[model samples]
Target: MITDTNHLTSLREQFAALRAQGLRARDAARKLALSEGDVMAAHAANQMHPDVAEHSLYTTMPLDSDWVNLLQGLENCGPVMALTRNDSVVHEKIGVYRNVSATGLMGLALGPEIDLRLFLSKWHAGFHVVEHTPKGEQHSLQFFDAHGRAVHKVHARPQTDLNALEALVQRHARPEARPVFMPGSPLRPPILADDRIDAPGLREAWSAMNDTHQFFTLLRKFEVDRAQSFRLMEGVHTRRTPLVSVQWLLEAAAGTGLPIMVFAGNEGCLQIHTGAVHRIEVMGPWLNVLDEGFNLHLRHDHVAESWLVTKPTVDGPVTSIELFDEQGQVIAMFFGERKPGKPELPAWRALAHQLAQGPVTVAQTEAA
Candidate 1:
């Protein structure tokens, strides 16, 4: 868990050096052993002050035994997959919910809340199962939520077949919890087009659906922003039309004078979005965006709010990019698409020389 030996050393030196300076940055510096600039600032602000009352209470009546029991209960519940692996950010999106076993028919759920009852009621016609996995453990579960983006996991516990899985789920499953389903008020007609046949069929289906049905149906495609289509649709309320491709949208974004990150969608696939976006365009499967030659230096799953990447490793080019995260760590690496025939670009390298010379910062006064 304690990563970055250099960072740790820097932390110690920073605090020691601050203490030597006889400055108010002492108390802050003393508690910290890492040289990270941000951590030092936090220390200086006295943010790390211990909660005395809470500490005293805990000392008198330690809750370690209770805490351990709580953790065990969560682990015993095992891992349950999301119906669809939509990134669990603060956003409303539509996606599918399927039982991972591949046995049940593919299920559907209206958005806002996508839960087990909704998936079972809508997709499986209320079929539940108890699964028996290789471990001989039995877990009653109905479905799995496959949140493949941020977390790649299958939600089902290893158990038996559909019937058994349902039985166990019914025993342990909470009945009151339900997935949010989008209400059908005014049907959202299809705007974008991929195939002519499918497009027309989608339009016909939209026109035929009632309000409630329309809401749920459109909720599935919620993540796919048909903003441009909606704008265009305002012109003609009737008749389905082909909305512009995500490629065109990215091209337009590139024309803007800003740094943009784009996950291009080739053919008819959906696009991936990231925070560090200025302009993004798609050329076939290859998404071409402006390159600042910066990369966030992070390992897989080592989430961070911001990364101050040092440039030029022993390998090659001096590339550094800062990445920001709230809770988990975000590792920055030079990532490129994998085309069928073309080779991929390597991640930014941090050679020894790059570290000696820090990042080149443009002066604001000079710019002014």
Candidate 2:
């Protein structure tokens, strides 16, 4: 799903035109080579729950099966160790760490904040404290194993506390004798504006969605940008219009009746459902089949924005740098891997800059 700006732009227009032609969802999907199931899901979800349909379709996916955690009780819970791309953070657990899901991936669930820094690279017997900085737009960190193998990571900010974060990962765990602190982030979502999930709209959309596919479509439509872009993909061209951003994405997901699975990169992506927003679990880089999850890209009319993330290679430094969109769409592929001698400016910042390129001038309007 690596799309250049031109390709994305064309896709948007194509989707809009197809929709205008009153083509069936199947036709448009076929034209786009997208999953007819996905579109049908979106369409059906929209019909059933028009109000919150977008949110649901874009964010939720329930656990396919039961996740049984091996660790139990307060002992399993401890300090939450966080490793972001830029820095690391820690949180102490005031409560029990219920093993929900780690970075949205299922498998191991346990309560307790394990020091990812400790076990990420090598088995250090002594304790150490690592300071994480957020100054230069640094947002995430990855953890490595004793053999210098990268295993865990976290995206910082949204202001997560140690305890709160620890609780999130501690609850879900696999039965391992020694509890190694892993890197994690707290789910501190941003606030939302009124339009994202209108209370009334959520209620309305909830009732409308007849099936899961429809639910996802509506949810997918929650973001003004994503929706518009999606419409553009279906062939709706919202050239330079103010589209939804990540803030809106979260709010819509939270307020809507549907669940969400965030297929994210440097930015974000969500697979919505009728229940809750599920975080897609990252099993690591070698798990390429679903490794990158799903990809989505939006670029300026001209510039090909580079979206970057730390990609893991089978054998190399902790990670390799790669780029993708909110939807996991790889835009630019950087092969040869190297750990930056110095922290290079993150690719997400570049994306932020590119996405911000617009005609909006905040210069001269007099307030009434």
Among these predictions, the greatest TM-score belongs to 2
Candidate 1: tens digits of C-alpha lDDT, residues 1-368: 12354653455356446545654222443255321222322222111224531211111110111211221223334333332222111111112222222124322222221222122212210112222224443322122111101111123433213453334333443333222222222244454443323434444443444332343455254322233322222323222111222222233323332222222211111122233324343434333444232111112222233222222222322222222233322222212222223332231122111212332222311221
**Lowest-sum lDDT 10-residue window in model 1:** 56-65
- The TM-score between candidate 1 and the true structure equals 0.19
Q: Tens digit of lDDT per residue, candidate 2, span 1-368?
A: 32244553455456556766877433675677653323322222212334533322121111111222312222333322232121111111122334433333322333332211111113111111112123333222232222222233333333435454345343432212121222233233343443554444443553454432353465445532322222222211111212322222323323331232222211111111112322322232211111121222323121222321222222321211223344323322221212235332233222223333432211211110
| Candidate 2 TM-score versus the reference | 0.22
Model 1, total clashes: 55
Cα lDDT listed for each candidate = 0.27, 0.28
TM-score versus the correct structure, for each prediction: 0.19, 0.22
lDDT for model 2, on a 0 to 1 scale? 0.28
